[model samples]
Target: MSEWQQRSLASLGNYENGFAFNELHWSEHGLPIIRIAQITGSQGIVDCFPGVLPESYRIDEGDLIFSWSGTLAVVRWSGGPAWLNQHLFKVVPAAGIDRSFLFHVLQASVAEMGKRTHGSTMKHIKRGELREFSVEIPGNECEQRKIAQVLDTLDTAIRETEALIDKLKAVKQGLLHNLLTRGIDPNGQLRPPQSETPQLYKESPLGWIPREWSYGSLGTWLMGKPKNGYSPQEAGEWTGVQMLGLGCLTKEGFFGAQLKLAPAGDRGLEKALLNDGDLLISRANTRDLVGVVGVYRDIGTPCTYPDLMMRLMPSEETSAEFLQLVLQSSKVRRQIQGSASGTSESMVKISSAIVTGLKVAIPKPDEQSVILCRSKALDAQLQSELQELEVLRAIKAGLMDDLLTGRVRVTPLLKSLQQTAAQTGA
Candidate 1:
């Protein structure tokens, strides 16, 4: 702590805001105009700028960029040379400052910057406000590098885990599509696609499916009517009854993190109470998300679904897990989205008729079990990696708080490493 000193962002670096590139300046082929949306990953850089601009506006790989409006985030640019758009600042670290350390510190300061933002629609901090934001840093550049090295290691692991998770998800998606169409053979292997082995498949309303599969409307496999859930006024206090939000049912499946407390005394509450393994579908949402399905797993609390969702129970002939996975298939998803109707494009509704009438290829119970077992195996791997990611993030957050604040000194750690290296060389 003795070597650490508080420093303002302006003192450690020059913050250069990018030029405002409007639609008129957008071109199809040229250097990308990096926007805040592109930094946040909500949008890609489709439009580029052909005209050369000032050197200050040109950002290359390994530069530090801070998006100051809407979303406050600090990113290390990894893409090729491009033009920087408005509301973003290109940070040039001072001679004594470690660029990597400065990048991590800025990321840690985003929440503080967010608190000082103005404007109702799009929040932004003035340059003066940003300049005053301070953080504690060690005066020694060597100590700074040590701290940055520790964080960078964790970041590398996090990035690799994220990449692996994405690849696994893509593989799982392809496998799922195959299982739903080509299906598992009697020997417990994926049947070859119709393109490779035409004799194994037959034509159906849904498309070419394995000969062992039967095609029919979803209603034929349902135990009873698809009941709509209940919605009551949101309770300010915990009333012991939790209601699932529209976000709870995602394409990946049920996520209870977005739950809201509901009044237990609501008249129709009993009807909406969910049982473990109960399959749910969004009755109303955006066209892309309207018919998203998930199964309610016990969260160790009494929870109910809202009116925007519908509950279904599969007949003895159907496996609930298989049905939930099937609903996520591109074919079934298209049917659900295609049948959806609403006055606003942002919000749409899918009725029971549409859900029941959607065509599907049903596999035998044993085959369904085999398919689910394999899918769950992949899902388990994804979830494990996801959990590892969460832990790594939490660890990074803690390390940044300690290492950056000088609470957990890296000077001693650095010396220990240096001694170990010398001994090894000897």
Candidate 2:
């Protein structure tokens, strides 16, 4: 630890929960009410609630707000007056303490606070507990300002890199949608069939596909579900068998990083061992998330799926990657949501029967191969961009830890902070 002073969070600021605003008082236009959902970052706010509030409920510029539920983070003012709701805690820093510095301290301690949270269901932070939390503050105001400036700069960089990555991904998704739905020929023209032959496009179980295409369900092609059934035991690193759960599947596709290793056991469902090119579809989840699909490119070791996921291995005619994309499309997602069954709002589940009945469009083998190759290339490019974004994010997180903790000095940036303050004052 650096040579610094320590103080409870209460010493620096008073924490007070916002008042409950009635639904009847809300209107489309008026003072934007700030809620826990709106306080997402250290500085300023985005996605404000479009509700009017009494003038007395307004929070002034530069006041900090922290979320009281789910995720906790300090909210900075963007030079505007706003009203706060019950799920937020406003922290008014005492004179002489930099609000930005306090925000950074609270953010850096979020991980520790999360671990300390106690609850069987929804975890939360009590005001008394938060007030007692201690933080190491720099010896002087100059030091505090320097630290906040450095961390803020790194955060800005990370945000910019993330934005770039998102734009690139959007571009790639657009390409995939176009390439798969309307293929490109050697001449770079859409491979639409001749206009004279309207029958060239025929209705299949999955909707209209090329006339010569076939329609089939995933069950028709898969060898069978993975043999090993679901395991309740926590996974270990050295365990030879790897088990893929719902976490491994992302909205875009399979995220290899989410795989966990399972210890060998006689969990009867072992027969469903996964292989390269195998497709996994989420079988149980929210209406929109259920039936999400991903193609397995590599399984480092033998892996089995939980009962909540369905394994799909296409027969000779269809490409696994092609089917994976088809399953992930908006049209297929709607079909899955429409087919789901459940009584409770939170218990929607898609059964194997529903999955087997899902209709898929299949093109000729050669065209399937073309579509698969193009998609894989685009996926590779997207993965590269995502990796780069992850690296930038890691750097920013590390910088935040060091800067906020006072382990790294930012004296060199003092002039920048002063200049920023001066410009804003002017």
Candidate 3:
């Protein structure tokens, strides 16, 4: 019948709890201490100690480790050699199971373990409960390895794709900083830095910019007094008018494709309906995200923003696209954040006075169009890459459920891969 046998996790591996290195023992540069946050995220080590601990408590790259409390996560310690701190379990295979197989099994159990965790605020997994967690593995070591190989390949791919996405985001940030400061020339090359092209750049209230680009206060570009939105009155199923929230805006730009329809005959419902080329700024939010900005690309149906946000209509002197970029740029973001006032950490707000009076560096309409077009192209690339990342994560999540749970076995797929490799001389 089935070659697989159910085994308690304790039988497959010996577990060692991490040493409780107190906060007093921390250091800047010494033996890196692996804490709970590190085990879950497990990025490069930070909190370190100068001294050494028992050899059993130490861990290095490729070691299988788990955080037993706070957050339950099984990780292969690849963040470099470090000392394992408290609330963690360093798993060492006893004899019967493959190391990678044990990690994959535990990784699959994280969700269940999280559910069963004790503590109302800070949950923890009991040692006995962790030791008793079970998984079925084929008795044959070859099959065990094949299964681990399949899961490990997906893990590797997911990690690499995540790293790539991070790099793409960093690149996009740099592109925005450079392009927004130095507008693209008609030749398509970026204008020289301020240091190199002093004549082309002139000092302004905002900063140095192309001499042709003159100072323009946000007021000059404003069509009228900034209008705050009307909040929906508990309109769960009401479908008369869609009401936009701060959530509709993202740093990547407007996700206005979806907005909750507001309650009927709401105050300011008529005036709040978003017009073409309206720039909405978050009048209130967290300190960092207080001035989050985006343009209403185009809403085909009836749409209006909520009280949490304000709409700024631009004049002929400025393009909505250009104003949107300026508002999102670091130069303007600093002003927005500095102007925001909040009583509590949970909520912060900026007044329309601060927004309308904020200074902005404006370019000739044609030059602004050039900068807008180029940034749009870069933004399109970023969005496409982001979509691919989403798909990869979804695929990985599905594979983990099926393959790890034995719903979809890898033995046959492994054999097929081996055969294809042999045929292709790979």
Query: What lDDT does candidate 1 reach at residue 298?
Result: 86
Best by lDDT: 1
Residues 12-119, candidate 1: write the lDDT tens digits.
Answer: 888899999898999998999999888888898778999988898999999999998887889999988999999999999998999999999998998888887899
Give each model's whole-structure lDDT: 0.90, 0.71, 0.81
Runs of candidate 1 exceeding 4 Å displacement:
414-426
Rate residue 224 of model 1 by lDDT: 81
Q: List candidate 2 segments past 4 Å from native.
A: 1-3, 14-16, 40-56, 60-63, 69-71, 77-80, 117-131, 189-239, 256-270, 351-353, 412-426
Worst lDDT 10-window in candidate 3: 37-46
Ranking by TM-score: 1, 3, 2
Model 3 lDDT on a 0 to 1 scale: 0.81
Each prediction's TM-score against the native?
A: 0.95, 0.79, 0.89
Best by TM-score: 1
Across 309-417, the per-residue lDDT of candidate 3 in tens digits comes to 8888888877777888888888888998888887885688999899988888887888888888878887787677778778877876787777666677777777887
